[model samples]
Target: MTETLLLIGILALFGVGLYGMMILHNFIKLVIALQILTKTAVLAFVIAGEMNGQIQLGQSLALTVIVADTMVAVVGLALAVQVRRHFGTLDIRALSTLKR
Candidate 1:
């Protein structure tokens, strides 16, 4: 019962993240949304692994995801900073207008 509730909560988090990514135009917000989406998958895996009695497997997978996500976030933020320096705004709509 607890696991089911947790899963439902995670699903809601995923939905919120997806909505933010799709509807928000800020580059930083998009990055945060992506992180949230990634975290939901990690959490789902951890929860399933625990339920299956393979906690080690889940922990390892979650750790791997954390490391990879850290790298991605760093790179993404760097790119965002560069975009801001070059374009003067982090809005997706503003960046799209640069396609001349």
Candidate 2:
């Protein structure tokens, strides 16, 4: 029963992340949406490992994912900052229409 609730929670989180990704246009918001999606994956991994009696492996993988996700967030935020500085806006559609 608890696992089922956890699974439902995970699904709800994933749905929220997906909705953010689809509806948001700002670079920073997009990065946050991506982070939300990544967290859902990490949770799923840990839960699956617990179910299979491989908690250590699952935890290690989740740690690795967290590390990678942090790097990605840093890079993404850096890019967003640069884009804002250059274009004076964070909207992805606005950036797309720029000319060299």
lDDT of each candidate versus the true structure: 0.90, 0.95
The best candidate by lDDT is 2
Instruction: Encode model 2's per-residue lDDT on 1-100: one tens digit a residue.
Output: 8889999999999999999999999999999999999999899999989989999999999999999999999999999999999989999987765564
Lowest summed lDDT across 10 adjacent residues in model 1 is found at 91-100
Instruction: Report the C-alpha displacement of residue 62, candidate 1, in angstroms.
Output: 0.5
Residues 1-100, model 1: lDDT tens digits: 9999999999999999999999988888889999999898889889989999999999899999988888888998998999999999998787775677
List RMSD in Å for every model shown.
Answer: 1.6, 1.8
Backbone collision count in every prediction?
A: 0, 0
Task: State every prediction's TM-score relative to the real structure.
Answer: 0.90, 0.93
Off by over 4 Å in 1: 97-99
